[model samples]
Target: MMENVVIRTVSRLAVPFIQIFALYVIVHGASGAGGGFQGGVVFAASFILMIIAFGTANVRRRIDNRGIMWLSVIGITIYAGIGFLALLMAGNFLEYAAIEAVLGIPHLHGILIDLVEAGIGIAVMAAMVSIIYDISGNGEESS
Candidate 1:
């Protein structure tokens, strides 16, 4: 963990902005450049930043292994649920348009696409954080 006050303060302040930017990247991906995978890496970057500034144990208090696994599960469920829903509606998996067709809701296609991206972002972020935590070792403060 970083002991420098300046670095710790700066990182603390920057984490929120980093997360917002990641969300922007994910949302904007629906229309133009950037997407789930990219945004996910960005989101995970914030947690990585936290680990650098605050250390694993500190971050873990906020989000532990169980929480990470739950996040992964929720994200995967969102993605797969949408795909299966489409399939049940007589369309190929992940066919966002089929949902719109069946529900007759205009503009649902874009929404569904965005949802899938959100799920991807969540899952990716969780996975990345999990890996980093594991690789960072047992969070013991080395003298």
Candidate 2:
């Protein structure tokens, strides 16, 4: 845990901006230079900052092991669900054209891409955080 008041304060202040930028990267991935992996790493970095400043015990209270596992599962489920839905629609796996036909909207492909990206970002973020906890040797309660 961080002991320096100035460091802690600065990390607290910077975390929000870091998160916002990560979101921007995730969202902008559909249109420009950014993607799920980059955004997810950035997002996880914010929590990592918190871990460094506040310690695992404090952060774990806010987000436990179960919570992290669920988030990762949910994210991958979303991604796979979309693909399966497309397949059920008689299209090849992950074929956005199938979704576009059903939705009948402009740029449906882009929308689907964005959704998948979001899912990937969520999964990666949770997984990375979980890894950090494990490496820190504080993921489990000392019973």
Candidate 3:
């Protein structure tokens, strides 16, 4: 584990900013550059930073295997739920137009799209963290 106070302090300070920027990227991705995948990757980087500073044990304590599983499930559920809802509304899978029409809300498509992106971001982040943990071979599973 990195014992350097400077590096640990810097990582601790930068982690939140990195995560916030990741969310920004995910949100802004709808109209311009950046998107779910990028933002998810950025969010995963926060955990990576933590691992680098404190080691896998710390990361595991914060997010165990079960926690990772829940995150993945929740993320996928969010995405699939939105898609199935659109289907229920008699539109194609993931068709936001039908949702917009049914919801009768002005400017809802963008928001729904953002929600989907958020789900994607969450899923990707979880997957990446899991992969990192696995690759690191950080002893046995915590849970």
Candidate 4:
């Protein structure tokens, strides 16, 4: 899939903007249609660009499978932890209001939620890239 020139070029060109947009989406999720899942996939596209451009070896060197796995786990943990914290505060799971209370600024609830979504995005991107790299066999294994 990454072999196509069009895919490679588009992915490369769109990488940065996609990432930025992803952040925007995650942050504005409460007010908009985007969220953690959408942003994470967008974030992962950057790495996908790297893999397509330089091959799997380069991507692997920059981000190994083990590291990606840990990252994914950590991301999930963070998301869950945040939800738990909200629950502990007597709010529904993942309730941004609880987070706002903790931060002492109710208005910042959206910001905090966005942060968590970003984390999830990071994790998803890592996991997806890792899977793609693994399947790609780290590029042509130099002679």
Candidate 5:
């Protein structure tokens, strides 16, 4: 638990940039070489960096166990909800075209894809962080 000023300051400065880049990857998923998995892994890497620099205890204090569970649930729900919405619209699962027609949006398909990517990112990030926390004995469920 030794605190080094230089290390701490550098980590503090770098974390925000890491997060921003992760978001950039998620948003630019449609344009080029980026998507939910890459962005999510990058986001999780930021937390991993925090765990290394600060400690698992600090990371857990920031996000907590219940928060992770809710994040996972919300993410998958958003994903499935979109699929179900398509079904309700009388289309097969994940048929974004149906969503576009029903909602009458010109570019709704791409936007919905982006939304799904975001959900996947959130879920992956939570899962990765939870896995790290558990492996390091920081998870609440750990005895």
Candidate 6:
């Protein structure tokens, strides 16, 4: 999927909208039955599309490897941070009740979980897309 996006420049135009929609899905996962993992994959698809349309060099110009790496790290850190916070408050990792108390929204456990999952998804997707872009040699030669 990433490869196809990178090779097709047309996808670039649609990437932004796709990413936004993915975020919406992630945020509303609790109500709509979607989650972070799904949204993250969708978000990553945007970068893959950019890479497909533009090539590594072009993509790199837009977003350097270092930046992508940092983003990946930050994403994972956010996931872990949330889990750690939950553990501190609830005595269990990723326990949303603890988070709810902290945030003063004790009734939105599902929504909170969805937000966390979305963070995870974004991170995973970005990392995966970066990896794919790094490995893919270049856009396929035009016929």
**Total clashing residue pairs per candidate?**
0, 0, 0, 1, 0, 9
What would the per-residue lDDT of candidate 3 be over residues 19-109, giving only the tens digit for each residue? 9999999999999999988999999999999998888888888888889989989989999999999999999999999998998999998
lDDT per residue as tens, model 4, 33-141: 9888887777777777777776777677877777888889888888888888889887899897976776687577766676688678777777787667667783553
Q: Model 2's lDDT to the true fold?
A: 0.90
For model 6, what is the error of residue 43's alpha carbon versus the real structure, in angstroms, after optimal superposition? 1.6
Comparing 2 and 6 by lDDT, which wins?
2
| Descending-TM-score candidate ranking | 3, 1, 5, 2, 6, 4
Distance from true position, residue 59, model 2, in Å? 1.0
Which residue pairs collide in model 2, if any?
none
Q: Across residues 1-143, which tens digit of lDDT does each residue of candidate 2 receive?
A: 46789878998899999999999999999889999889999999999999988888888899888899999999999899999989988899999999889878978888889999999999999999998888875436722
Best by TM-score: 3
Candidate 2 TM-score, true structure as reference: 0.92
- Tell me model 6's lDDT, rounded to 2 decimals: 0.74
After TM-score superposition, the amount by which residue 106's alpha carbon in candidate 1 deviates from its true location, in angstroms, is 0.6
**lDDT, candidate 1, 38-65, per-residue tens:** 9999999999998989888889889888
lDDT, model 6, position 65: 67
Instruction: Compose the digit string of candidate 6's lDDT tens values, residues 44-67.
Output: 777777766765677777767677
- Pull out the clashing pairs in model 4: 40-121
Specify the poorest-scoring 10-residue window by lDDT in model 3: 134-143
Q: Model 5, range 22-105, lDDT digits (tens) per residue?
A: 999998998899998899999999998888889888888889888998999998998899999999998899999998899898
**Positional deviation of residue 22's Cα in model 4 after best superposition, in angstroms:** 2.7
Cα lDDT of model 4 overall? 0.75
